[model samples]
Structure formats: structure tokens, C-alpha cells
Target: MNTADMKSRHTGGSLRTGLPSTAFMLAATAYFLLPLWWLAVAASKSAGDLTTTPSLWFSDVHLAQNLQELWTRDDHIYVRWLLNSLLYAGGGAALGTLLAAMTGYALAKYDFPGRQAAFSVILASVLVPVTALTLPVFLMMSQLDLTDTYLAVLLPSLVSPFGVYLARIYSEASVPDELLEAARLDGAGEFRIFLTVSIRLIMPGLITIFLFQFAGIWNNFFLPLIMLSDQKLYPVTLGLNLWNSQVIHDPVLRTTVITGSAVSILPLVIAFLLLQRHWRSGLAAGSLKG
Candidate 1:
């Protein structure tokens, strides 16, 4: 074919491929964003107006009133639930991420007896669905008389096999044996090397782990439901579920539930926005190593 004809054909093929990808991206973006848009619009309406108005458009602007009621109702129980979620997600993620990073690093870098067995066990744990373990966990908690406590939720949240797996993969790719040997030659203790040299290098991986664990804990419902019977101990997920059940009988609570859900998503949004950079950087580091 002539150069001009070939160029035209290549350009046409590129257009055909790119157009579908662009369209798919736009469709996916809209699909994910639609719920958020609906929540934002719904949060602004009063209970009476929420059902009557278009879900995508505002009717009565009662955002302020709804927020006021949300804050003031039941002596600000929503605030308490928010605090509980923060405690569970923040503490659990921090502890879980640290432990996962440490375990993964050890698995990736060290030689010890039963190391392969331990790693195999961890991988097995990942395959076990969390729901199946809930009853056994609850029974253990009952035996310990630890049910209805923050530890009941937070403790379990800290044991994330998936985080450990991710951290292991990241550590194998991002951390080099030469660096560890260098640190060792400099006479740094194993723990000191981990704290100063290795931890900083693997920080992006740790942050990714933390964000995953945080989101998991924040959205956790069934575990907490099975563990705690006291309403005061409820996380926002369970608390919101309770409110939703009551919304059927009390129509006024419909707006409250919608507004609460909108508000509930804020922390997750903030977390993603803050940690996305680390996640991207971690992926880049892994890719570069590969």
C-alpha cells in the first residue's frame, strides 16, 4: 500500500479502538457517580419532600434542618456512631497495616523454620470467607465475655490476611536484599533496620494496606451485628441499618437516613483522596521493579 493509504488506515483503526474505550470510561464514571449525585440531592430535602420530589433534583432545601436533626437526635447518637467508626477503622487499620507489613517483610526476606508453612496458613486464611468465621468468633468472644466491646470489632479487624498478602507482594518487589545487607553491615539491629530503613521504603505499601483495612472496617456490618447487641456500641453501618428499619414506620426518618448515609461516606472519601497518592506510588514502585 502507499504510505498515505497506510497512514489513513492506521488512523482509522486507532479511532475505532479509542472511541469505544473513551465511551466505556465515560459510562463507568457516570455509573459510579450517579449514586453519589443522588445522595447529595436527596440529603438536601425534607422527609416529606424526599418521596415527592425528583430523586436527582432538589425540592425543599432542608439540608440545614436535616443536619440539625441528625446531630441533635437521641443526644447526638450519630456523632457517637461516627466516633466509634473512626476508632475501629483508624486503630484497626494502623495496627493491621503495621503487622501485615512486618509479617510480609519477614516472609519475603527471612529464612526460618516453618516459614513456608506459616505463609501457607496465611494464604489459607485469605480464602476463608469472613461470614463463615463470624459464629466461631462470636462464640470465642462469648467465652471470653468480650462481646459488646470495641475490642470485639477492632481486634478482629486487625487480623487481615489479604493485607499481609499484598504487603508480601509489595515487599518482594519494592524492597531489595542489598539494602538490608547494607543496613546489617552498618551494625544496625534487625528491628532498627526495619524501623528506619525498610519501613520508610515500604511506607507506600503500608498506606495502601491501611486504606484497604480502613474501608473494610468502616463498611463492616455483619461482624459487628453478631458481636454487639447494645445499640450504644453500634458502628455507623449497624446504626444506620437500625434507622433504616425504623424509617418504614416513621416516614420523617427517611430524610434522616438519607442524610446520614451521605454524611457517612465523607470519611471514606477523605481517606481515599488522602491515600490515593500513596497507592499510585506503590503500584508504580512495584511495576518499576518488575
Candidate 2:
């Protein structure tokens, strides 16, 4: 059969009306993009223009000035918040990924006593809501004199039960037992085998774990909110919330808050786009192996 005829037959000779699919796709696009579009418009307007102008389009084109105000206003605390977010998220994600990878590799490739029990505990911890632990964590930090310190936030952020789970699954699929056995026969230590073989094979899964943890730590608010009393220690999420709350009294801050919100989303977008290739490859490899 001809290709066109076969396709038609496979489709049951239905009328070629793609209108529903097209409309659904357009609706989905608008649903996601409309808020972003409004934010762009809102960010560009000054105090008066925001109220006077239409929300979907540009008015005074004062986004540059608004960004300047965001930086210079309020003791330039916005800049400090941005830096603190980067430090907390970046450092936490990196350390968390490393520890998760090591733990997962050991769990997957090694035979030891209490291994299953240890993994069961880690998995159980994953089921516990972080919000449930916040008060307890804060109390412990207070007793240890760690509250209000950077360690209070970064230390807890480093633990990722989900990341370890993903790493274990990926390690089992990607790193074959024969390879480790051969490496051992060649006089390579367990750490050397993990470093040289297992790590390279599991790179995609590691990237996925890093992205998840990065987004989590970057957008974390509750931990920082309760653990930190000083404004200097607040992450961007908490700082922006503070700015948003005061908008009721000083409505002029509305513009500044919108501008900060717009700027804060850029790092996350860039990070995801940069690592998206690895993420796709990792998920694809996992699914295919399964």
C-alpha cells in the first residue's frame, strides 16, 4: 500500500480535522505564558503607569529604572539576598549531590551488614514531610547554638533522600557487577572503581538529582524563615516575601517586588536549560533500561 493510503487506513479514514489539537495547544501555551507576559508588562511600568496602563503590554518601558531601584533601594538588600540564594542553593546542591552519589553507589554495589535496614531508613525519611520536621529541626539547632547561622540552613539542605534513591537505581542499571569485579581483579580499590567507572556511567542521574536539589534549596523559605532571625540571613524567597508583605503600606514597592520576582526566575531558568540535556538523557536511559 502507498504511504498516504496506509496512514489514512490506520487513522480509520477519519476527517483530517486537526483543529481540536491546535486549539488545545494554543490554550496551553497561553495559560502558561499569560502570567509571564503580565509580569513583563508590570515590571516595565512605574508607580503611576502600573495603575494607568494595560497589564498585557508595555507602557513607560521603565524596567531598567525599576531594576535600578530594586538594587539601590532598601540598603541594597535585594542584591545581598540574591547572593545568599546562590550560595545556599549552589553549595547545598553540590554537597548534597556528592554525598547522595557516594551513599547510593555504596548501597547499590556493595554487600554489607544492615545495608537493607539503612536503605529502608533513608526511604522512610523521604516519606516524611519537611514541614513536619521544621519545628523539631529548629529546636535542635537552637539547643546546639546553630540557629540563625548559615549552617542551620545549609546543613539540613545537604541531605537528599530522593537523590540517593535515584542514584542507587541509576548505579544498578548503569554499573554492571562484572566491571567492578574486573576492576577489583586488576587491583583497583573500591573507591577507585567508584570514582572511575560508576561515576562516569551515572553522570546523567547525578545531574537530575542536582537540578532537583538546586531548585528545592533555591526556593526554600520555611527553613530559612524559622531558623533565621536576622534579615541578612534570609534567602531570596523570604526576602521577597517580606517585600511583598510591606506592599500594603508602601504600595510603591509593588513595582520593585515585581521586578525582583522577574529577575529571580532567571537563574533557575538558566540552570535547567543548561542541564536539560543531561536530564533528558538520564531519564531516557533509565526508562529504556527498565
Each prediction's whole-model lDDT (CA): 0.90, 0.92
Instruction: State which candidate has the highest lDDT.
Output: 2
RMSD to the hidden true structure, all candidates = 1.6, 2.2
lDDT per residue (tens digit) for residues 47-78 in model 2: 88988888798877898899999999879999
Tens digits of per-residue lDDT for model 1 on 1-290? 89999999999999999999999999999999999999999999987777777989988799999999999978999999999999999999999999999999999889999999999999999999999999999999999999999999999899999888878888787779999999899999999998998888788878878988999999999999999988888999999899999977988988888899999999999999988888888767756654
Cα displacement (angstroms), candidate 2, residue 210, comes to: 0.3
The weakest ten consecutive residues by lDDT in model 2 span 10-19
Give me the overall lDDT of model 1. 0.90
Candidate 1, superposed: residue stretches over 4 Å from native? 286-290
| Clashing pairs in model 2, backbone N/Cα/C closer than 3 A | none
Residue ranges of candidate 2 with Cα displaced over 4 Å: 1-22
